[model samples]
Target chain A: MLKKTALHDAHAALGAKLVDFAGWEMPVQYRSALDEHHAVRTACGMFDVSHMQAVDFSGARTADFLRHLLANDVAKLSAPGGARYTCLLNPEGGVIDDLIVTRRDGDAFRSVVNAGTADKDIAWFQTHAAAYGVTVKQRTDLGILAVQGPQARTLVVPHLPAALRERAFALKPFTAAWEGEWYVSRTGYTGEDGFELVLPHADIVALWNALLADGAMPCGLGARDSLRLEAGMNLYGNDMDETVSPLECGLGWTVAWVPEDRAFIGRAALEKQRASPPRRMVAVMLDGRGVLRAHMPVRDAAQRDVGQLSSGGFAPTLKQSIGFARVDAQASAPFEVEIRGRWLPLKQVKAPFVRNGKALV
Target chain B: MSNVPADLKYVKSHEWVRKLADGTLVIGVTDHAQDALGDVVFVETPAAGRKLAAEESCAVVESVKAASDIYAPVAGTVLEANAALADKPELLNDAPYGEGWLWKMRADDIAAVDRLLDAAGYEAVLAAG
Candidate 1:
């Protein structure tokens, strides 16, 4: 049976099309994906992301444990409420998952991971924590809601606790603060100024209703995927997997190579890869009349097969198709994508084709 | 929902065919199909004057999420193709029965139309699943 989230009824009430996604029956779209995508880019939109698992680590050695487990340095989260984006990798430096880790206190931190990989991530942590005496707890009682867009802050501020409102408004990017029972973080996947709120699951329905009454549009996974793609964010399994390394997945910037004395799980293998990186992830904009889709073959100027599109879709904001392709590092700026046996011309551009309702390409 | 004129015929796969004043028949996907496809992004139609057999794959419609093949409802020779869809494919989602018609064909055997489902039978097929 497919698992359902706390907001499943709410999605159905709004006439959303629900589909099975990674073991959860979730809303794929409400009304139209293009409209929802435009709404989040132009104004505000909310997503019920309760399916994502939240794991908490608490112990004197929590920081130490994470330092050795993550490819990025978790010690940099020295200040309370600071958050860092990092990747957990295998011994060979292949990506296990990319997640956000926030320091709630000196000995406690919260990490939210993808729903499909939650069990494996928790098991990995448990297996590694035994040596460090750290405790890993999955908080299934909490519900997460991401309210994102240019006007997201304004829509959510009035509903927050008065004391927490000011701090949440002032919170820096990638930081979270505890307000009573709510954990509000100024972080999002839409490349917009927004807050991810973690609160009691029982209170989610009331909160969702309040947000809808305040004119915040309810969006679903379809808009979420398109919005994140436009923001150039990577989906866990699609953009990279166990066989792919972070360096080749447009995530080398997130790796921390400092503190040469401290070796993490994947450092040596990564260092060896750094000497000779094999492939590079590039963003391609389809210039012709075709939609870029996953597994579509990419061709070089000579029409030789170089790589394949890992993720692709039509950007409602840009009115064009865009995608990420893993191609040989030697493949230069111009390329083409094979769609329906015809090579559609494309231009390799910097990521984030659109953000904040504006085309950045 | 709009009515699927009784005079026209449909396939369980959702293609619709209407006999024009001339002996040719017009072909397109149904509104139900376009709604399921969300926003139509690109379309690939067969060239004009090509001959197609009944149930033969004749065109392709691509949305943001998936691609679908449009099968020929009956054996016919392609008479004309919708040139407007080449630049504006969303017409398939906006007007699947009118401006979004994919192609027109001259039926090789007019009796082939009798084998197609009528409006009521097509609706029953849609209601089943």
Candidate 2:
């Protein structure tokens, strides 16, 4: 049986089309996916990301444990409620998962891992945590709701406690603001202004309903995927997995190598690959006819196979097909991708296809 | 519950066929197919005057979720393909049977429509799935 979120019935009540997503029965869309995608770009949209699992760590050595586990240093989380995106990699320098780790308080931290990789991530966390005397606890009682777009904060501010309302706006990107049980983070997967609220299970449904009444369209995984792709955000399995490292996944920036002495997992392998990387991930756009999907081959001039697309889809905001592909580090622009027997020219670039509802590349 | 028109013939692939008096048949995806496909972003129809064999892949439907191939039901000569879908692919999801018709073709054998399942039979195929 597929697992259902706390808002499963609420989604059905709102006419959401539910589908099995990463073993959880999640809403793919409510009324229309394209409309919801536009809502997030132009206005506001909400997503029930309850399927994502939040893991909490608390102990004297919690920070030390995290510093050892993640590729990104947690020392940068200088203040409470600060979050940073990082990758959990195996010793082989392969990305097990990417997550947002938040510092709740001194020696108390929380990380929200992807829904599909939550279990594996928890197991990995628990295994590495004991050595540092950290106690890892899965926050099953909490659920996540992502409200994104230009008007997302306005729609969410009224719902927050009066004391937090002002602070929420002041909350910088990649940071968080919390009061007792209410947790709101100014972080989101979509490259747009937003807040990801971490609420208890009992409070999620009520807030979701209130947000809907507040004119925040309830988007689904479909719109979520499209929006993130337009923003050039990477999907876990689609972009990186155990077989690939951060070096060629358009996430090399997420890896912190400044503290050379810090022996984080996969650091050794990454150091060796740093001097001469085998491949580089590039964001690509298709101006020709046809959609770009994951695993599509990317070829360079002379029709030599270079690499395959990691993640791809139709960008509703841009009204074109966009994707990220891991190609030869030596490869340059002017790539070709064959779709249904016809070779279509692809434009490659370094910047994200879109950011903050604006086309960048 | 998907709308299965009783007058139109259906194929197991979820395509609906409307037979005309001139032995020319109009082809379009059914409501069930469109619903399953989510929002249609693009549709690639076969060129007009192309000869197609039974069960041959002739067109493609790209949606937000995934891309799918549309197949010809029986041996036929393509009369005309839907040009509007190139500009407005949402028609596949909005009106799968009307203006969303994918193509019109003359079947090699007019009696081939008899080999196709009727509405009830198509619903049974969907139910079995």
Candidate 3:
């Protein structure tokens, strides 16, 4: 049976189209997906992200444990309220999952991981944490909601309790704050100015209702996927997997290489592969008709297949088809994607095609 | 509730058919089909003069969620396709029965339309699911 989130009833009430995603019965779209996609781009939108797992770690060795557990160094998060994006890798230098770890204090940190990999991620954390004398607790009592867009903060602050309103308003990008029972973080997957609120599961329904009353459109997984893709963000299973290294998956920036002696998991394998990476990830825009979808073959000018699309779709913001592909490290521009037996040329460019409601491509 | 026009004919595959005065039949997916498919992003209709057999998959309607095939209601030769959908595929969602029509085809046997489902039959197909 597929699991349902706290908003399952609300989604059904709103006439949402429910589909099985990662074994969870989640809303794929409420009304038309195009309208929801445009809402986040121009106004603000909310999503029920309660399925994502929140793993809490608290102990004297918590920081020390994470330093060894993640490819990104936890030392950079010396200040409270600081959050860092990092990759959890297996010993083979392949990404197990990409997640965000935020520092609540020196001894307590919270990490939110992808829903599909929650069980495996927790198992991995538990297995390795025994050596560090750290306690790993998956907090199922909490529910998460992400409100993203240029006006997200303005639209949501008024709904927060008076004490939390100011702190939420003052939050900086990538930072978080704990106001009483609520945890509000200025982080999002949709490349927009927004807050991801993690609160008690009991409080989410009322919060969702309040956000809806405040004109925050209820966006579903469809809009979420499109927004993230246009923002050049990577999907866990689609863009990278257990066999793909962080360096090859456009996540090298998340890997911290400083303080040379800190031997985080996968460091040795990464160092071994750093000299000659086999694949490189790039963002491409389709110049022809038809949608760019995952697993589509990409060819170089010589008509030789060089790579495949990791995540592809129509970018609502760009009003064009765009995608991320894993290509040969030596592959250059003038690329083509084979769609419906036709090899259509693709325009290669630097990533982050859109951000903060602005077109970057 | 989806709109099921009483005068039109439908197929089990969710496509609706209308016999035009010129004897060519106009085909498009049903409202329920478009709603189930979500926002149509790209559509590929058969080229003019292409031959199609009954129940054959002749067109593709792609949404962000997945790509669905639009099956031919009867054996026919494609007369014209809705070229407008190539640039604005959302027409399938906005007006699945009107501007969203996929193609116009001259049927090999006009009596084939009588063999397809009627409005009530199509509703039963949706209800059974």
Per-candidate interface DockQ score: 0.67, 0.84, 0.81
Poorest stretch of ten by lDDT in candidate 2 chain B: B65-74
Q: Which pairs clash inside model 2?
A: none
Which pairs, if any, clash in model 1? none
Off by over 4 Å in 1: B1-7, B47-50, B83-88
Instruction: In model 3, state the lDDT of residue A34.
Output: 82
A120-202, model 2: which lDDT tens digit per residue?
99999989888999999998889899999999998899888788899998999999988877899998878899999998887
Which regions of candidate 3 deviate over 4 angstroms? none
Candidate 1 vs 2: which has more TM-score: 2
Model 3 complex DockQ against the native: 0.81
RMSD of 3: 1.5
Query: What CAPRI-style quality would you assign to candidate 2?
Result: high
What digit string (tens of lDDT, one per residue) describes model 3 on residues A204-312? 8899998899899999999999999988999999999889999898999898999889999899999998877889899999876678999999999998889999999
The best candidate by lDDT is 3
